[model samples]
Target: MSKRLLARVAALTTGAALAAGAVVAVASPALAAPLGTVNLSQTSGLVTDSPMFASAVTSAPCPTGFGEESALRIGPAETGPFTNLTPSLGGGGYDKAPVTANPNRSFQLALGSAPANGRWWVVVECFSLLEGRHPDRFVTEIVVAGNQWRVPVVEATTTSLAVSPASPVEAGTPVTLTATVAPSGAAGTVEFLRGTNSLGTAAVSGGTATLTTSTIPAGSWSLTARFTPADPGSFGASTSAAASLVVNGPAGGVSKVETITADVDPGAFTLDVAQPPAVELLGGQVGGTATGALKQATITDLRGTNAGWDVTGQLTDFTGAGNIPAGNLTWTPSAAKASGSGAVSAGTPANLGDTRTLCSSAAGSSAGTFTCDAGLSLSIPDSVPPGAYTATLTLTLV
Candidate 1:
């Protein structure tokens, strides 16, 4: 997350790389190179009157926003008597026009009324909404002998890689490498490499693959990503151009006089509970209750662990001249200080006769200081003999 400009550069570079590996940057001036040859999808000889199928390959997509339509037609001569294969023949047209989008387009036609012993041309015509009709382009030739044959061609693919932290980084710094494959949806795995050695292979997802590593030594590295397609007949293999990285050695060029002399303790989960001020019944009553503010209690977690803790409190029977039951004390706990605004929480109200949680934190959440306080209530049964009773409230953290 350095400069936004650098992120954009990486993205744009990836797009250009996948268009033609690294060659796209300096390739032919023709920004639009959509015309490619037409061929059958199979090597088997075309059957007479039966459906004959083929796919045309295009080097690039159609001119943008033109609604350009590509029609596949067949004929005996390259010049005349061609029929568009639109249900009038064997009834088929491109799956997705190789001319309009990708290289995996198909068309079918029948040789029902023609003499079976001659050559036929599988032609592609490009007609746009406003641009009208373009020229016919063909690559592979076909022959016939009671069965017409068309050549089958596979689509070619390109791969591009991007690396980050574009600037020189310290040795052992984690670096991210991403590979983008074009025509957008080629299925394969990308192998990330440094020089000739591979760092690892990552499965392509959404036409892109990624790998992260932090084990590089100090030096300059030429990194690349090689794309190995799952179906070679449908798409071809490709490798991205090498991107460069420079890693500096460990910190140096400074002298140390001497090491300091201080012993360091790992850490501790320390808890401090303050004694509460005296609680007094404002008026004499039978089976009555008194409420007071509980003192603040602090808990700090420095153990560097993924554990949680709870602080509970219980009370001893009140005793002065006479005794009162500890069960008469109840508290509503609150966190005066929440370490992460979430890690620690106040506990529910409970009488102190039995230990009850006052404050607590979940595992992996107890990493900072937290302070807790509560409202205290003292309820005495009418039968209890009381005279200035006192009790101890024990708080424990674990």
Candidate 2:
């Protein structure tokens, strides 16, 4: 990004330099022979290759901030008829002068309409460097034609977009969605939609688009406006991608936290602990009164809508009073509050029933009713020994 100055000039063969503050005067014969036909030739400036979106050096900055750089010059081509000249700036064919800041320093020309994303060049005055002569003011001869090239866009581009937990989703749970756009301009907006209902819109700088739903009502939805052009006529048209999202269930409604179970080996029994259940630990006597243990649970996926779902669970040590109970002691209920941070396809937590639990048991008997000192609490059970246990909990998300 250099500084620039543009000066417009015309030839006045016999014009004399002006005095300190007086205007210069041109000498002309009152009745000189009729002038010859004034012919104009088509000419172009110099061309250079540069990266896409890269700025071109127009005029060099002045050393002491003294001299100025003028705008592009109009001239005839080498072998064409001479014609009138018109000044254009910024490559838009707009009749405007080149802007400048420092008098004799460098300046830049903005490269526009360059399709690709790479190198370009700037047209500058032609000057000669020789010994002893400063060229007075670095006088340059302007060449016509050859002044435009392409530069890099310095941005990202995407071919399409995708939504998690595909359409027809349940309400309440969060549904995470993402979009892809190509040639992501400097900056723009990506809009989300539910059949034109504008779920919401997000700002994308590079080439990514993200949107989250607040447990939308069960129905179909779509994503749009993945990409936009920097300026109209930019590349001639606009581009975008699309995706679908469906939501199910009621709006703003709450139901009892569902329970989970597991299907495993007959002897090894699989305890389903998807989401935490109302009764984390359940145990009854196969003979002598059976007792419960430290109980706690963290509920989730009440209705199957959490796009990103996860939970944590833990149970305390179990103690046997004596010996008398039979029927191969079994822990009826499992802990369902244990889970790690995780992600689901695409669907709101409110609309998905995704949860887990943990459970442990030991055979014993011979004593008063089995009593668990530490009752059900959110905290991990302390009576449970340190050991890892995995269980499966089945839940309904309707």
Candidate 3:
């Protein structure tokens, strides 16, 4: 072979060798660029009761022509092979599903079980294309809870309750009760309780609940307001300080007088006459024929009056044919009886066309109530026509 031809062959071999070396260098794995700056939803004040969130934004895309996987792990500060709290991302692996050219990524880590009560850290690992079975990237570590993350020890919130018409309300009067909850942004309802009995439940608006009722008994009452949080894990239940309410009994006074009038029914009466052989006749007696009930009056004078009060009644004679004398009918009033207060006296008897005092109560006496029970008696004379007789009776109070 010629010497020039041999030199040309050697040059071609060197060129081929250099090209193979370049290809090998391109395929080999190298340290990956940073995924980006990781930002936690909450860094220092995280608690085990709520979910954790994280996000990362990259200005530059993932290494071209290579797939990347993102993952999040939480464990004790000095532990290796930390627990994969978000295994659902990568099918039970600490790595998330692979993606190409991810510029921005976010993760929501809801730990299936609460971690041990201690300090913990969150590690975000972004892996480049795998070489065989191993990731070719480093992890970014963040101290989420230096010492603050643990099972939450919730503290109760203060509450205040108030009642309208504060106290000493007259019986049968309606009252309004209101409760104000602290952390006014809390969302839920409030239940009002009287002693141990539940009055009702009211939805909270602007952190306040109110109830109005008129059925509360006349006595001292203890009222309380209980708050039920919509999310118990986020906030604790709270109860208001006990409130006092007093209701008073009704006032004392005289009631309006009521009047009742009744008619009389007189049956046949036997008559007796003095004559030869002393004849005894049927339906001939002058009197013992008329029957009647008294006109009634009821008065309630609960206020012990300094001066006495009197009840009087007046009667008018009948005006039918063969007029019977006004004096023939007599009216008698029975003793008045009082309930709960004051005494009463019997009334005087009077003929028709005259007024008679029915009852009287003395000063400072326990006789505040009065009722009338007047009776009437009729007298018929011989030779009187057989007819019905009626009279009007009027009762007055002073």
Error of 2 at 384 (Å): 99
* Best-fitting candidate, scored by lDDT: 1
Candidate 2 on 258-295: residue-level lDDT in tens?
78998653221112221222232222212211122222
State which candidate has the highest TM-score: 1
Q: Candidate 2: which stretches are off by over 4 Å?
A: 1-159, 184-186, 231-241, 251-398
Cα RMSD to the true fold for all candidates? 30.1, 36.6, 49.4
Separately for all candidates shown, the number of backbone clashes (residues 3 or more apart, or on different chains) is: 0, 118, 10
Can you give the lDDT of residue 209 in candidate 3? 84
lDDT for each of the candidates? Answer: 0.59, 0.30, 0.49
lDDT of 1 by residue, 1-398 (tens): 11000000111010000000111011111111224455445555544424454444544333232224565566675544555653211122332334422222122333346445555565655553422343224334455555445443468999999998784999889999999999677898999999999899999999999999998777888999999998675689999998999988789734346767977665767876554333322222335544445566788887777488898876677664456667766665777455543377778545777888989989877778899776555555678443445566667789
Candidates 1 and 3, the one with greater lDDT: 1
Instruction: Summarize candidate 3's per-residue lDDT along 285-337 as a digit string, tens digits.
Output: 33322323343456555543435567665545544434556565554456555
C-alpha-based local distance difference test score of model 2 = 0.30
